[model samples]
Target chain A: GDKVKQSPSALSLQEGTNSALRCNFSIAATTVQWFLQNPRGSLINLFYLVPGTKENGRLKSAFDSKESYSTLHIRDAQLEDSGTYFCAAEDSNYQLIWGSGTKLIIKP
Target chain B: GGIITQTPKFLIGQEGQKLTLKCQQNFNHDTMYWYRQDSGKGLRLIYYSITENDLQKGDLSEGYDASREKKSSFSLTVTSAQKNEMAVFLCASSIRTGAGQNTLYFGAGTRLSVL
Candidate 1:
């Protein structure tokens, strides 16, 4: 079984629309981190959570360690938001287990 | 306000050739990591160093080697390149806080091609 799994492997949305990405952890997760790998291939850190929800601008993320899952919601999506989103979970050993990723395309 | 720099943004090597990728971080982070990303796949940890002169093997460290002689730099070496191998190597750094993990800052990445 996958230690970390991401759903909706690919998503397409219109600008100004909304969408959500999810990650399921089979291992015991203590913390979660979300990152966006842009078209240029540079990864940008989006949110880091510890069993709670966090919001930054149009992006919001929540981590439910007890349930072993996390969610990233994008509100009012923009073209620049088009990229691959990755979620990583920190296990008890403090090692990060990564998800395959979700490829997002926001069309204008 | 710091940046992680990976040298030789691109690399091409022949089969069985030994190639090295270098990373430097100005963040002065205590922990640095090397991850390999395959097309449409997730990042796999290769090696990580929690401090200078220390190394920890990740799940995918089998065919690779890593060095961290200085606090500001960490490097990964491919012992022997495989023919038709292609992947992106990413370097990241983060400060360890208390007993948990912190946010990570990654470099642009080094794309490798083996012929």
Candidate 2:
């Protein structure tokens, strides 16, 4: 189990409120990538889905390869948008399955 | 718009010694990766290469030892060093792989400390 599963491991938002981040794939994923591990750790590269949806400025993403799951949405919530939030998946032999993050904390 | 240089961002080994980590990429990517972040646990894919010298082995890849030698460089070696062995070693690059182009470009990690 847990080929890739991320959820409210941590989140605090406030600045402008509105948040959502998730990833759930047990395999069979086609493609999904979303990252943002700022806070000096640098790992930025949000959204790279394949199933559908994709935005930018305020962030918005969604990928549902037959419900394998994948979603990340955050609007207005700034403070530089906090940190930690990863979701990676790419099965079908492409390999790449990682999810154990979601620590955003945009206060003030 | 390409830069993935990771080297001694901070690394200190001792326990058993033998450590080496270095990655350089100026785009010219062909596929290169080596992840291993272990705090909250997630990124794990010991090695990968798809061009110069090619070599692939993920899922932790044993004691670890990788080298791509060319195409912009990629090297990782930590044969021993294991004593608490803190983690944080990520180096990625993608520009040639199947579908979607496997977009991945990261490098700003290499915080190992195994005193």
Candidate 3:
């Protein structure tokens, strides 16, 4: 069984549209982190949450430790937002359990 | 803002050859980690260091060695490269915010291919 499961293995959306990505965890996660891996393979940190919601620019993220899930929402998606999104949960042991990731393509 | 730098953006090796990857961080983070990502797959941890001279093995630690000789640098060595093996090696560093909680920042990654 996967400790961390991500939804919508792939997603394609038009520019300026809004969409959401999610991660469900079967482990006891204490914290969660979201990242976007650019085409060049550089991972850009999006948010770090501790059982709450955070918003930055056009991105918003929320983590509910009790519910064992996390969500990332993108508003007015831009072409530069096309990339792979990954979320990792820090377990009780402090080990990061990673999700398979969601490949997002923003079409013009 | 700080950065994490991984050397040799690309690496090619022969089967059974020993290969090494290096990472340097300017964030002054106390913890560093190494992860391997195969094509179309999630990342698997290789090794992590909490501090200088302190090493911890992750699930995929077998056949790999790591060193944290200095606070700002961590390195990973593949004992024996497998033919046709291909993966991206990522290096990350994090600072602890609270008890058992951390946020990781990663480098551009190193692409490895073995022939």
Among all candidates shown, the one with the greatest lDDT: 1
TM-score of chain B of each: 0.96, 0.32, 0.96
Fraction of native contacts, model 2: 0.71
lDDT string, candidate 3, B1-115, tens digits:
9999999899999999999999999999999999999988889999999999999999999999999989999999999999999999999999886565577989889999999
DockQ of 3: 0.79
Q: What TM-score does structure 3 among the candidates reach?
A: 0.97
| Superposed Cα deviation of residue A71, candidate 1 (Å) | 0.5
Model 1 over residues A69-102: C-alpha lDDT tens digits?
A: 9999999999999999999998898889999999
lDDT of 2 at A105: 90
Across B1-115, the per-residue lDDT of candidate 1 in tens digits comes to 9999999899999999999999999998999999999988889999999999999999999999999989999999999999999999999999977856588999999999999
Best by DockQ: 1
Q: What's the best-to-worst order under lDDT? A: 1, 3, 2
The order of the candidates by DockQ, greatest first, is: 1, 3, 2
> If you assessed candidate 1 against the hidden native complex, which CAPRI class would it receive?
high
Candidate 3 residue lDDT tens string, A9-69: 9999999999999999999998899989888888888988889999999999999998999
TM-score of 2: 0.33
Candidate 2: DockQ? 0.29
Alpha-carbon runs more than 4 Å astray in model 2: A1-14, A17-29, A33-50, A54-59, A63-73, A78-81, A97-107, B1-14, B17-35, B38-42, B47-79, B82-85, B88-112
The TM-score each candidate achieves on chain A is 0.98, 0.35, 0.98
Spell out the clash pairs found in candidate 2. Answer: none
Task: Give stretches of model 3 more than 4 Å off.
Answer: B98-101
